[model samples]
Target: MQLALSTLGCPDWDLERILSVGRDAGYDGVDFRGYRDEIDVTRHPLFTDRADETRSRLESAGLSISALSSSITLCETDDRAAHVAEARRLVEVGDTFDVDRIRVFGGGDPEDRSRAELARAGGETMREILSIDGAENFQWVLEMHDAWTASDDCQQLLDELPADNVGVLWDAAHTIRLADETPRETLDALGDRIEYVHLKDAVYEPDHNDATDDGYVYAVPGEGDLPMADVVAALRERGYDGWLVFEHEKRWHPSIADPDVALPAFVEWFRDQR
Candidate 1:
């Protein structure tokens, strides 16, 4: 598996710093979530106006863009057109970066609707997004996030979508923490459609004592009980050679370790695993 780090980890870093540090840290690629204060890469000047320069810079740094992690939520009832347009725009940006995968979120509350309903919503939105010309060439990856952390729920969403380009972005932490699935079980169930993996670690604290409302606190790779090693072993056993993205959520949670401390640490830990 190749290693990549999400720009979500270092939201304050500019594009040059991101590529330079990532290259030096032995990262094979970067999962572009944001750069500096810009939350949307497609709108950012580096990607929109200076796209060619950005690509050249990335190439010069010896790094590829593994994926463009967008905030397009499919299961939401609000602004469906905006969601589809955003996804289409991201696909356009993906083309510019030679990126084949675009990360999206399966966001909704299970308590508000059945998993099937959520899946249907996600499927419909995905179908609409895929209808755009050239959109089918890119994999619109649905991340295991929000209420779709459960493999079965994610499977339900996949079942509703018939397009082969739609795939899963397996976030190991969520499936384990929220759905109570072991690494092997998650891979066994969603292995076929998983196109990318988000590597994060955290421990469950039932008393809501952590940064997360659900009591899950972020930990550097291998420091928490996330079964990351087992997950990697399962992927290898399945002959999966995809991007293993280290998703450090420092942007949303400022209390977490800075990227300066967390980024190289992940590279060392990942290399040790090899």
Candidate 2:
């Protein structure tokens, strides 16, 4: 498996600077995010229809686009079409960059009504997305996030329509917040559907009203009292040899901490584990 850093660590830095930092720090790749303020789409071709340009920058930086930190969730009662459009744009960029995967979250829960209808609608959407030309160029892995992470929700989405491109991103923090099942239980349920993984540590802080208030709010890896080593061992036991995305929510926890400072420690932690 390879170690990578999310651009999320250096939210204040430009993508170029983050690229250089990751290379210098000996990270393998970066999780690409297209936040408007962080990386202006108007000025940067990485957000535009210029895949070659984005790929060239990363290649020059000695980094790979491990996954696109996309905001595509088929949920939200409104703006579903807009979300799909956004996803299409990202897919074009991913194809150009030859990115391995594009991160996504599956459909939302619309008040637990009409189970049949929800299933049908979800299947249709997945089919349309999977059938999209060139979507196969990059795998679409749905991070088990939001409230849709319950075993039934995940199983239903995978069961209703098992597309070749459909896979799960095993995010420990998100799963810890959203599921009653242990990581082992959830992964066993997901079985072969898991394709990507995100690694981070945070403590359940009730000081705030956000989700992190109830759980780890972007704490440094191994700092919080999470069984992260066990989680890693679990993934390894399952033969999950892939990227472990480190996410420091610099957007929300701007003053909390930064990834650049926490990364060297994380690399050491990883090395020690190995």
Candidate 3:
């Protein structure tokens, strides 16, 4: 699998720094979760008015855009038009970079509604988004997060959408930390439908954890207690050759290692696995 760096790791860095650091760190590409302080990169000038310049910079650096992550929540019933409009804009930005994968979130509370109900809502919204002229050309990957961390739960939502363009962005850490699932179990459940991946490591801290309310503290890829090696092994066995994005949550958790430190550490660790 190819390794990529997510912009989520360095919210403080400018676009130039992001590209330079990622290329210097030996990453194959960069995944745009945001640009500096702008969580919606499409709204950022690089992706909007100066899109061609940004594309030229990426090509000059020999760095591909692995994916574009958006704040498009599929399951939310409110602000349907806003979500669809955002998706359209994301498609426009993605086209400029020839990026085919766009990350989305399945954001909703299962306690408020059953998984089936949530799936239906998310599916309807996705259908509307896909109806956009060029939207069908991209793979809309629903990230395994929030209420959709478990493979089975994500599958329920995936089943609601068209199989042709919809798939899962398997967040390896979440399946283990939140759903208590093994890598093998998650792969078995999602199978080939996992079109993209977000990899991070963490140690369980049941109490006094300031980084997260989920009882886990983010760690550098290999230094943590997460079953990362097993995750790689399972994906290899499945012949999955996709981007393994180092999703360092530096943006959310300032106490974690900086992108300059954590990003290269992941490349070194993952290379050791090979």
Per-model TM-score, in order, reads 0.95, 0.87, 0.97
Backbone N/Cα/C clashes per model: 0, 3, 0
* Higher-ranked by TM-score: 1 or 3: 3
The stretch of ten residues in a row with the least summed lDDT in candidate 2 is 34-43
Better of 2 and 3 by lDDT: 3
- Model 3, residue 211: distance off in Å is 2.6
Segments of candidate 3 deviating more than 4 angstroms: 207-209
Model 1 TM-score on a 0 to 1 scale: 0.95
Question: Model 2, which residues run further than 4 Å from truth?
Answer: 35-44, 49-53, 110-116, 208-215
TM-score, model 2 to reference? 0.87
By lDDT rank, best first, the candidates go 3, 1, 2
Q: Could you tell me how far off, in angstroms, the CA of residue 139 lies in candidate 2 after the best superposition? A: 1.4
Error of 2 at 87 (Å): 2.4
lDDT for predicted candidate 2 compared with the true structure? 0.69
Poorest 10 consecutive residues by lDDT, candidate 3: 204-213
Per-residue lDDT for 1-274 in model 2, tens only?
6778876666677767777778887778888664436432323565565656766888898888788867666544365676666667767777666778888776566576554556566666656666667776777787777656776776666666656767788777667665756678877888588777777777677664443646456676778756678777888889988888776666666765666777666666777776
RMSD of each: 1.6, 2.7, 1.1
